[model samples]
Target: MKHIDVKEIISSKEFIGQEITICGWVRTSRNSKSVAFVEVNDGTSLKNVQVVVEKGESDYKEPRVGMALKVTGTVVEGRNNTVEINAVPEGITVLGDAPTDYPLQKKGHTLEFLRTIPHLRGRTNTFNAVWRVRSVLAAAIHEYFQTHNYVYVNTPLITGSDCEGAGEMFQVTTIGYSNDYKNEEDYYTNDFFGRKAGLSVSGQLEGEMAATAMGKIYTFGPSFRAENSNTPKHLAEFWHVEPEVAFAELNDVIEIAEDMLKHVIRTLLDKCPDEVAFFDAHFEKGLRARLEELISHDFGRVTYTEAIELLKNSGENFVYPVEWGCDLQTEHERYLSEKVFKKAVFVTDYPKEIKSFYMKQNPDGKTVAAVDLLVPGVGEIIGGSEREADYDKLIAAMNERNMNLDLYSDYLDLRKFGTVPHGGFGLGFERLIMYTTGMANIRDVILFPRTVGSIR
Candidate 1:
């Protein structure tokens, strides 16, 4: 008989009384004098299937938690309206034996402890639910873009330009720590690419190039940063979802961001019911309601200046005091979304001094046409801006920043050759997962999270 997944065997009653085979890792096992109860999970579902073994069975062996087993059995109606498997005679085989020293036990393990054993943590309830939701959310993102007539583009992982201008990029070098060169320029000349190259911090630049031609494009891939901050919200490597649209302005991309996020939330709530319920029950109470509330109403909108005024007058004791031209901190952002607006809010037209050089300069001569989407639980979930389409303005902005004009000649060429008011936004995929699943740490949502001094 074909091996049926534990998820299928437990979810439906069609397999009752039918002989079948199943393979999975033991979650928990209880052995009495005459019978043994083994709960097994194949990572297909949040719940497990109970495998009952009789003491007289020839091949019956006491299965331990974390042990991989293959069992041929007959599905039967279990107690309390559930389905279980009754192992047949000589039908139990141990594929892999986890000894008594197995790290995972029936007892609860803290998230910090699980990080040390990233390899085995996926078998746990929390990680299994997180990964399952992650898979569904990834697919939902693709579905949303594809159905909306957006072209999916793959930007290069390695690039010669820093998209965010922060200079926090991981250098991709062929040379080791050897003083085998004359100068900074000469050192890179002998290296691969014959110039400075690093893992991309954002795909927005290449994504803009694709958008100008393809009309609408988005890139979903891994992004790297070399920041040294050790925080629950920060990561060295994370997935980025960026969408660029031609003939679009700051307001247009803001609408796209809101609609795309709502669609993704609806998809998650509909498809991953069990996983969401588990997260809601354990991780964050009312997580499901929070998601529903987001989709129920329109996001609030305010200018950066207006937001600053609101914060200054709100009389809330803020850790970082609110002021004009100063970038809004998480406290301020959460206050606007959670306390003031009570929903997702868009703060737009920030001062050009604090914003990137690529953003379009507004008529006021002080602020850029930039916007950040702040949600209730997570602040600044999405950041985007209208590109500076005028060649002179872009050149002036680059020159003011003392940027290397030679490196960005290709990106500059896009403006010179019929640029049409293009714009885009980037969504940190892990941040979205953290908001949806209520997983507090950025480390927990990602598989094998690469954080400060932690690669394993």
Candidate 2:
């Protein structure tokens, strides 16, 4: 009596008529005078298997929703052209019982309520589909980089310098609220790392070092930002996918980013058809068509100046006014990608002042070789820039920003020694999942979302 998976039994015809053992949590149950019908899901598939128990069956009990059950049964062609399990006498075994207080019921529940119980949300259809697509997309990311000969680098979680220069980091410390320190410097000196250290906001800095040595490298790991934003798009902790390429210009990385995204979309469409359909039918209509459209068309490309001009000329009322120097907001980004381009667009050559300190300064003196990939619905999907390879310019930029150069001495060493033209981009893994699954909130995609004022 081999235990068969619900997914296998539902997807294959070979399992029909064969006596098999299956174990899963009961999703739904209905009982009559002589027969009991229980729908069981094993987490292997979104669909549940129907287990029919006849009267006078040995150890047979009316299964309740959320109860764990093991049963031996013969598969038979059931109603509506589907297969079902006919439980043998005395074959039903209750592994675990669910109390009446079980939160999950047959009735529909809102996403808000599901967030309160992150532990049991996986059993629900919506979350089960979301997690399945997340797994496939994660694997697709690794596949894209590995096939391109990029070395996967595991960047450190704790760091001494802020990569984004935002100063919004969750500080890592051994001393907790101890008033024994003399001053700011002396306080840090007494701490574990002997200096200020915090969770990394981005892995691009160290990824550049690996890229310089290995020619190409990528990092996929947890990144933390301690911003007090309670928006759907912001998260205190999230996963980041960054790939750094040596001897590559801004345009080179843009092409790579486009190709990699198309590959991921195509892979997801192929591997997770059922889950994709689920999202399309429930979450967002035309979701499948949107994904197909992205892979079918070449992404649009425009300079930052050109994009701003397009926005300004369109005459659409925008909350944030379009300006050459100001950063593009989500509204402006969506207008460019969704309304104007009708596809993914790469906006390049942003004003240097608005971007980070490491970007290469263009010859125009006002802009850096930075690029952002914007798609419909989602504003900025990927952002990267050609790093300032020149040591003098790198130092000048850091000085202009009034940064403490000593903290980034090792990062500066990369520019000083054997520096080559290099560039890379970061893709917020959750954002990508949100885009693919049509999940409105970032919390719905991640298993345990860490946001402002909420650790659970």
Candidate 3:
């Protein structure tokens, strides 16, 4: 009577004996003189439903793998009450045909090869599981924040100020090619918006603005970077989850981040058992055990100075030299989490010169109140710090760096009017997905990855 999906029929036991219309792409089919068996998947889950069709019972267009079909059938029960459909040949319709040259058939494909066909990769079982898990992960993030009374803030994409102050931003311009820029600095002053603007590298600054007013706010949106890195972990564009909390210090934000991560991992285990199991078997062995271990114990916390000492004392030779003021490389981060802590660890109190200007300077005057969360497999999953609340101190820090004064007047106004001790951390959405799914490359988790010299 009504159209239903393959998942519904497979899940609902009462659907047996009812007449239903099912539409999906054929995964595999076998034809015979008396009967034809077809496996169909509707992208609802990792599993597929089986359909039985008798020859000459009605109009039966021979089905092929990758072909779209509409089949009217009566539900039947197979062994162990497995729900199946018996197609009425007269009601069958071949919606779309796939040629023999179909790129994807019933075979294994390398992840490298799949990247070339981004549009059609979803048809594969691996990608189907990846995207479905990604959907659930995103919902988990929103659910975790919303239930915690954090207001959702939509930060602007085009920003005039560089939040990280590293200047890795994609410029937005409307100047026509007909007019050559005699002065690069003068071009932006005369272009659209009447000033320089670029895609935001981080929504932390804007999120902080909302947090000062809303008390607790989170921003989940797309962020861009102009860095030309070709590493497997880097992306030109990615999704970021940032939560800013007013009246919260560095330790406060660290607690929130740990709780949020555990909550999402627990939710994923509860919701997507099959998808998680699939990845555990294929991508990462002992994946569930790793996440369970993470939630069961408290994450180890240590100072950046302490981490450097441990690394330096170790006998292993590192490619990059480790010093007190130097940044921690990915290899060093992984070593701390995997070998030293054997779980997720939070390294705190980084050198002030290496951190951003917004981070609050510590009483020691050498380091800032910044923390980086590193996991066993992934190097650095999050970076956050307690913001500098004093107006005079912020101005001094900015002036020391010779930052553009005109671009951050509004930001400074926030501190001038009403400022509170606030702190926040940013989580790369793709990196989390990769860690959860045991996906090695960052590009595999993203649907259409944008990296150095690659747009399509």
Q: Quote the lDDT for 7 in model 3.
A: 81
Error of 3 at 384 (Å): 0.7
The best-first sequence of candidates by TM-score reads 1, 2, 3
lDDT of 3 by residue, 375-403 (tens): 99888999999999988888888887889
Count of steric clashes across candidates, in order? 0, 1, 4
TM for every model, in the order presented, reads 0.98, 0.98, 0.96
Candidate 2, residue 342: lDDT: 95
In candidate 3, stretches whose alpha carbon ends up further than 4 angstroms from where it belongs are 56-59, 176-181
Candidate 1 lDDT over 372-454, as tens digits, reads 99999989999999999999999999999999999899999999898899899999999999999999999999998999888
Kindly provide the TM-score of model 2 when superposed on the true structure, using C-alpha atoms: 0.98
Backbone clashes in model 2, listed as residue pairs: 58-90
Backbone clash pairs for candidate 1 read: none
The lDDT of each candidate is 0.93, 0.93, 0.90
Candidate 1 lDDT trough over 10 residues, lowest sum: 54-63
After the best TM-score superposition of candidate 2, give how far the Cα of residue 88 lies from its true spot, in angstroms.
Answer: 3.0
- Which run of 10 residues does model 2 get worst, by summed lDDT? 55-64
**Residue 257, candidate 2: alpha-carbon lDDT:** 96
